[model samples]
Target chain A: SQQGEEDPQALSIQEGENATMNCSYKTSINNLQWYRQNSGRGLVHLILIRSNEREKHSGRLRVTLDTSKKSSSLLITASRAADTASYFCATDPFTDKLIFGTGTRLQVFP
Target chain B: EAGVAQSPRYKIIEKRQSVAFWCNPISGHATLYWYQQILGQGPKLLIQFQNNGVVDDSQLPKDRFSAERLKGVDSTLKIQPAKLEDSAVYLCASSLDIGAVAGANVLTFGAGSRLTVL
Candidate 1:
């Protein structure tokens, strides 16, 4: 069974706009990670936010975690055309295994 | 360092036939995983190995699917009598270990093998 589900299944925005995607999981997690995948390629790890941490930032990517609500959100600021891809949120639910979300498809139009 | 490597980027087989995909994880990585990703959906964990030992195969269809990680390094996943529903991308991922240490369990995925069953 899937442990996480992402909202806004698909989003299209201008290259300079920001894109935000939300994820909700069913159980408690030790950490939440975000990844990006280009078409026909493997996924690339973006950032990971531990349950104890409320938010994290890397480059233009900002990830916020709300353990109390079992939710997380990823924000890509000053998005670029290269940022167009599928984004996923994976949760490590007290185990070594990481369960992934349904993913959000973000398209940046130039 | 080189990333995870997978073989046969694409494959096409008729239903009831057999097919196999190979994966070579990053050197020194001890944990490897196989996931099946159907179109427009999230990847589902099929099997996980911790240094040649099976840690989880709960979601694997043991009846037709099998996998092995020899010498705790390279791995192979095989499907006998494949079905049309088996058409999807097989993704291989690996991590240093299953350790609980923060920021150490990130998985590095391969390009994946896309299989098409007719």
Candidate 2:
């Protein structure tokens, strides 16, 4: 079973616009990480937020985690055509393995 | 400084036939993982290894799938008598260490091997 589920399974936005995706998890987690995958490619790590952290930013990407609600969101600001990809939220429990969500597909039209 | 490496970027085989994929993690990485990703879904952990020792394989189909990471460097995943549902992408990833608190073993994944069981 998947530990996390991302909302807005598919999204489309023009370049330079902002795109947001939400994820809800069922279990407690030590950390939540967002990853991106170009179609037919392996995943690329985006950012990881620990349970103690609320928000973090990397370049044009911002991620927020609310442990109390067991939810998280990934926002890509000033999106570019290169940002077009499927985004996934992965939760790591107290153990080693990471359980992934269904993912959200974001399309950035140029 | 190289990234994870995987061979046979793509393969097509008939059902009931056996197939195998290989992976070589980034130099010096101590943790390795294998994941299965069916189209339209996220990747699922099939097995994890911490330097030649099995860490977790609870989700693996032990009856047909087998993996090994000897000497803690490279690894291989094999499926005997493949089934139609076995068609998917197999991803291999690695991290510097499983216990590095600062890093927490953030993974670096390979391009993956796409398999098709006809």
Model 1 over residues B63-113: C-alpha lDDT tens digits?
Answer: 999999988999999999999999999999999988735544799999999
What lDDT score is found at residue A75 in candidate 1?
Answer: 96
For each candidate, the alpha-carbon lDDT, in order, equals: 0.94, 0.93
lDDT per residue (tens digit) for residues B2-101 in model 2: 9999988999999999999999999999999999999999999999999999999999999999999988999999999899999999999998887676
Q: What residue pairs are clashing in model 1? A: none
Cα DockQ of the candidate 1 complex: 0.73
What does candidate 1's lDDT look like per residue over A64-97, in tens digits?
9998899999999999999999999999887789
DockQ, all candidates in order: 0.73, 0.69
List the candidate 2 regions with Cα displacement exceeding 4 Å. Answer: none
lDDT of 2 at B17: 97
